[model samples]
Target: MTTVLYFGLFAMSFDFISGYTGYLSFGHAAFYGTGAYTVILVANGLVPLFPTSTPFMISLLVGGVFAVVLAVVIGLVSFRLSGVYFAMITLGFAQVLYIFVRGWDYVAANPRDGPSVGGTHPAGFEIGIPGVDQLNLAIGVLAGEEATVLGHTLGSTAVSYYMVGLVALGCYFAMQRILHSPFGRVMLAIRENEERAVAIGYNTYLYKLGAFAISGFFGAIAGGLFAGFRRSATPESSFYFLTTGDALLASIIGGFGTLAGPLYGHLFDETVREFLSKSGQGGGLLPYLRAGLGDQALATPIFGDMTLGVLIDTLLNGHASLYVGIVFVLFVLYVPDGLLGTVRTRVGGTLADAARDRFRDDHSTPERTEGDDE
Candidate 1:
């Protein structure tokens, strides 16, 4: 779930620009990597002038600023083109960064493996109000704080979950607010028809650039949060093009153009992955089947030396990607608008509006008398 929160935020940031502007940022992971590396580097005191004592919140903000700058640099050139060309260019930039980071010794002793939080910073990253010890709460699986309230004790993992959730929720609302603004409407306009938007005297390029920068800022924050919680960042995990691909997959599964849809989509993805995990981390199918079925049934051969358990293990134990891919294809073919988008369409507006209308109809319905039927 913590993975869903931070990665969901990254997906939402991707949707903010790609879904709204119809310009896919195939290399959006560049900003994500930058933010992750920045947080880890700052914590290790390798970043110039920024000491290891720098507050976690400050490091996140600094990373966000860095992402914004990187976005501007990338967008300046990429936005000059449109469609697949733009995507390829952005992807090229990200790939270049990935390779550089993979080989850059300045980043770590073994840059290929990336960096981890060392002796310079041993505590969990704080996530509340900066400079206020009481207001702040540390977040990490093992390094977080634990508290008891009303005889119920919250463990470190639970504390990290709530803190990370709070930040992700805040970022979601901020993006939602932006989506409802005039600037966001312009973004929609550009997506609908760039030529028409240009004809209307709007500098579509600048709007796209601004949107890209904003998205990058949020994307970086998400990366920083991820690094904060894990206490590590890696090139393959953070800078790889597949990182952006994951966000793209979430946006498509959740609902492109619907700001909050990607979170649900990513949650679904994670749920499926965990369920089919080889190690059965979270009560996966393999463990359940093994526990439920006896050894006799499992050992019974259905084919040439392939028993029931062996078949299940071979086909389903760690093949979540196959199932997820099938689901994605079904969604594209039958539910093109995605889960939330289809619901919104059926409701004729947002979920809140639908609920309000239902309430009004229920209250305004005329009362029936005994003779009314006659």
Candidate 2:
């Protein structure tokens, strides 16, 4: 679930630009990688000027700022063209970065494996107010601090979950506010019809550039959070194009234009992935079936050499991608608008608005009609 929150933020950032502006950023992982690498590098004292003692929050902010700058640079050239050409150029840039990072020795002794937090910073990354120790709490699976309230004790994992969740929630609301602003409306206009927006005297190019930068900033923050929690960053995980592909999958499953949809979509994705994982990280199907069915049932053969257990192991174990792909295909064919999107369309307004209207109708006293007076 913590993984879902941070990755969901990344997906939301992707949706902010690609979904709203109708410009796919195939290389969106570039900013994500930039942020992750920045956090790890700063922690390891590999980055110039920024010492190992730099606050985690400050490092995250610096990474986000760097991503914004990189976004502007990429957007300046890519936005000049539209459609697939722009996507390809952005992807090309990310691929180049991926290769460079993979081979760069400055990041770690083995750059291909990326960098991990060493003795320089043994503590978990703090997530609350920067300067106030009381207001801030550390977040990590093993490095986080635990607390006991009433009779219940919260473990380190639980603490990290709540802290990461708080940050993810804050970021979501920030993006939501932006999407409701005039600038966001302009982004929608550009997506709907660029030529029409241009005819109306709006500089679609600049709007796109601004949106891209904002998206990149948030994407980097997501990356920082990920690196903070894992205490490591890898070239394949951070800079690979497939990272952006995962975001795209979440966007499509969640609802491309709806800002919050991606989070729920990613939640669904992670749930399925964990359930079918071979490592049994979350008590996967293989373990469950093995435990539920006795040895007699396990030994029952369905075919010449394959028992039911073997069949289940072969097909369901670690094959989450197959089922997820099927669901994706079904969603594309039948539920094109996506889960939240279809709900919004059916309700004829935002979900919050619909709920408010329903509440008013249910509670408010009906007006006295003329017939009632008679």
Candidate 3:
């Protein structure tokens, strides 16, 4: 759930620019990776950029700044091109970064895969609230050090979940505020018609650059949270174009332009995946199906000695991705506006029609005065 929240926040960052400005960036992961690496490096005192050990929260902010700087540089070059050319340039830049991280041991300790920053205190990148000794962010279970909140004992993972969720919520609201501002309106105008926006005295290039920087800043924050949660950073996961692709997918499915929709979309995606994996486990859907079919039928051998139950479980576990892809295709064809967008359109139209009818009836009916009655 924490992972979903951070990923949702990241997706919203992408939507803030791509959804609003219609410029689909394919290198958003560059900012994400920069954030992850910066946060870890600063927190661990691995980089001389910060003296001594930096606070976790402070490092996160610094990481965001780094991403913003990178965004400015990338935007200057990438924004020069429009449409598919822009996307390809961004993608090319991200791939170059990926290759650099993978091959350079100076950048990442384990260049082939990535860097590892997880372990016990004093060894790993330990994050916690400033001046609060009791509250520390640790991934997974923290045995013998569990803290109770509101009479409920919360483990390390729960603590991380709450912290990350709160940060994600803050980021979501911030993006919402930005999207509702005048600058955001300019971005929308640029998206609708860039040439018209330029004719109207708005510098379209500057507006796009600003939006890209904002998006990159938030993306980095999400990356910082992710790195802290996972206690590691990998070029394959963080710098890969597929990372941006996942966020893009979430945005589309959740409803682009709705700041919080991606969160719901990501949550739904995660839920479906969890359901698929657990369906094959001991008390899951597979067991229920087997029980309903009974032993003889399940053992009836659909292929050679392989039972029906085995086949079903195998498909559920192994071909889960295949099923997800099919569902995505269906959504694209039938529900192009996305889940929330479609819901809002239908619900809003219905309410508007109802109100119009009510207004017509009320106005059409003449008031029965005393003289008229007589």
Best by TM-score: 2
TM-scores for all candidates: the values are 0.93, 0.94, 0.85
lDDT score at residue 372, model 3, on the 0-100 scale = 94
lDDT of each: 0.89, 0.88, 0.78
Candidate 1 structure quality by residue, lDDT tens digits, 327-359: 989988998887788899999989989999999
The superposed Cα distance between candidate 2 and the true structure at residue 40, in angstroms, equals 1.3
TM-score result, candidate 3: 0.85
lDDT of candidate 3 at residue 336, scale 0 to 100:
82
Backbone clashes in candidate 2 total: 0
Per-residue lDDT value at 232 in model 2: 80
Error of 2 at 29 (Å): 0.5
**RMSD values, in order shown:** 3.0, 2.0, 4.7
Query: How many steric overlaps are in each model, in order?
Result: 0, 0, 0
By lDDT rank, best first, the candidates go: 1, 2, 3
